[model samples]
Target: MKAAIVPALNSPWEIREVPTPEPSANQVLIKIGASGLCYTDVHITKGAIPTQFPRTLGHEPVGEIVEVGVGVTSRKVGDRVGVPWVQSGCRRCEWCLRGKKMFCQQQIGTGVQTQGSHAEYMLAYADSTMLLPDSISYEQAAPVFCAGYTVWSGLRFADPKPHEKVAILGIGGLGHLAVQYSKAAGFETIAITHSKNKEKLVRDLGADEVVADAEALQKMGGADVILVTGNSYKSASAALKGLRSDGRMVLMGISEEPLEVTGDIITNRSRIIGSMQNGDEYLYEALDYVAKGKVKVISETYSLNDISRVYDRVANGEVRFRAVITDM
Candidate 1:
């Protein structure tokens, strides 16, 4: 089996032939069809996300189940599924017992702490695997595992009202999908970005309006729910200025610096919240939306052998939205 391995911290992806892994009693073995490369992959290579050496670094993987372990009944051979983040939590914990597994401190994170999907074959915990819809291809469904799932979960965290407006900050990978989901839900969607070139693309994705920044969002009568998808905490901090009274700002982006909160962001108990992949219900609905064609993943594809080149492109910030590693 050919797999891309990160030999050490700050190292490039080395394509090597390794023995295929056998699934454990509670797991299933999959023949990976596609994997999405995220900016977090670059951070992993640079040791920004602390990870063990000689690791596989992709969390967004969709493929076919070629084999299943003895104890697995929920999934079987020939099943099409995706191995996503939030694999499992310590089932005994309070959060897990209460059904809020995403809050479990002993949660298992794909790629960051386990063998990821940057390989031809990998073992997945049967319980955490999601059954893929027949209408969505592996390449298109790959990003939904992380980018799509996170933004949608953030929007849910915002809990917008029927007449409230939804605004998306940053028009990159996650933001692009956020705009579509916001519009598809029948809200007046707004996209906030400095890139003049993305106005048409954003509009084409069903953005009802486009704004340059926080100030521009304010002029349009503030948004009831703001989903922040850029890694810049300053941008996220500034975006709070555009949140209407009692509105919620859901931060989906990960940043190194502290997110500053000011008096302007505190009107009528408005909330500043951080969110990631939420409950299973959110992921199920997120996948359904994309499967039904309400959301689209703008992506570029590469062969598994060219995984290193994917890194270079990601480092140069050249990916249109997301990069998928396929047989192409």
Candidate 2:
């Protein structure tokens, strides 16, 4: 099997032939149909998210099951499935016992700590794998595994009231989906960005309004819930000024720099919260929204052989929204 391997930190990615892996008792082997090249993969390549050398880096994978282990009764060969970040966790931990496995201290991250779907075949813990809906294509459903689920989970964390103003920061991969979800959730959806070019695109995605900057947001009386999807700390900090009193700011992007929070951010008892990859229940809900066309993934597709070029495009933020590597 051929896989894209991170030979070492800061080194160029290499496409190498490797031995196939057999699934363990509680795992399933999948023939990957498509994999989402996310910003998180770039972080792994640059060592920002530390991991062992010679690792395979791709967490959002939609594939067909080729083999299942003895203990896997919920899944079988030929099952269509999608794998996310939470590959496996210590079932004995308090968080895992309470059904919040993502918070387990001994969580194993797909692509980060384990062999991921950057390869033609990979092992997915049967319990963590999500059954993909037939109505959604593999390329489109791939991003929902991570980007879609992240924003959906973040919105749930915000818990906005009916008809409250909901603003989406940034207009990239996650931001685009956030716009649609916020609109569907019955909020007066707003897409906030510095780019004038993205206004029409955001509006087309069902945003009730588009604001150019934080100042514009303030003039509109601020948002009740702001979903931060851009990785820029400066932009996120500026966005805090546009949150209404008692509003919530949900951070969904992974940034290297610290967010400068001022006393004003808390004057109204506003909350600054963050969300990680959610459980299977939320992932299914995210997929259902996509399957029903309520939420869509704007994406570009590439062959696995051209993963290096695709990686460069993702790292440089060149992909319009999401980038999926398929034809594997």
Candidate 3:
């Protein structure tokens, strides 16, 4: 099987012929149909995510099951499934018991801790795979495993009211989907972006309005729920000023800079919460929207042999939204 591998830290991606892995007990072998390349792939190459050398870098993947292992009666061969980042964990662990499996000490990350799906075949725990909706294509449903799941889970965790106005603090991969999800779920959506180039694009994605910054958002009327999906803590902090009193703000991005908590957080009792893809139920809801055509995932497709080109465009911030390798 030909797999894309990062030989070492900061090394170029090479398509190498490697032995295909067989599924162990309670696992299944997936013949990857589409694998979505995330920006985190760049971090993995630079050793930021801290994985072993010669790793195949991709987590957002969907494919068909070719074989199932012992104790995997729930799924069978010839079934379609999407493999998520959190493959599985020690169920007896504290985090796993609490349903926050990603934090489990022995948690397996699909691309980071195990062999990823950027190849002809990869192994996945049968319990961890999502049954892809027949209505959604492999390319469209792939990003839902990561980008869509992250944003939708964040939005739902924030718990916006029926009449609440939702604002997205970025308009890139995650934020664009956040905007659509906000609108699809009946919230009046606003896109807060620093990129002048994305204003029109975001509006076309169903954002009720586009604000340049927190101040601009403030002038347009403060939002009841703000979803911070950009990778800038400074931007997230700045957006806090536009949060309505007693509003909720969900943090979904990662940044090195510390977020500044303003006085309004205490005086107005505004809530700030951090979230990742919360649960398998949330993952299904995220996919349901795309399956029903309530959300459109913008992506550029590449052949499996051209996986290196996907990395170059993503690193340069040239992908329109998500990039999927489909010709595997």
What Cα-based lDDT does every candidate model obtain?
Answer: 0.89, 0.89, 0.91
lDDT of 2 by residue, 1-328 (tens): 9999989997888899999999889999999999999999888888788899989989999999999987999998999999989877788989988988889878999987788888899998898899998899898889998899999999987889987899999999899999998887778999998788888989999999999887899998999999999888778888888999998999988887788888986578888998876667778889999999898899999988999999999989899999998878
TM-score of each: 0.97, 0.97, 0.97
lDDT of 1 by residue, 1-328 (tens): 8888999989878999889899889999999999999888888889887878899889999999999998899898999999778788899999999998778888887887788998998788999999999999999899999999999999987788899999999999899999999998889999999999999999999999999988989888999989999899988888888988888989887789788887765555789888998888888889999999999999999998898998899878888999999882
Pick out the ten consecutive residues of candidate 1 with the lowest summed lDDT: 261-270
In Å, residue 1's CA in model 2 sits off its true spot by: 1.1
Give the per-residue Cα lDDT of candidate 1 at 140: 87
Clashing residue pairs, backbone N/CA/C < 3 A, model 1: none
Clashing pairs in 3: none
lDDT at 165, model 2: 94
State in Å the error of residue 85, model 3.
0.9
What does candidate 3's lDDT look like per residue over 214-240, in tens digits?
898888779999999878898888889
The TM-score of candidate 1 is 0.97
Q: Report the lDDT of model 2 for residue 21.
A: 93
For model 3 the local lDDT of residue 52 reads 94
Measure candidate 1: CA RMSD.
1.3
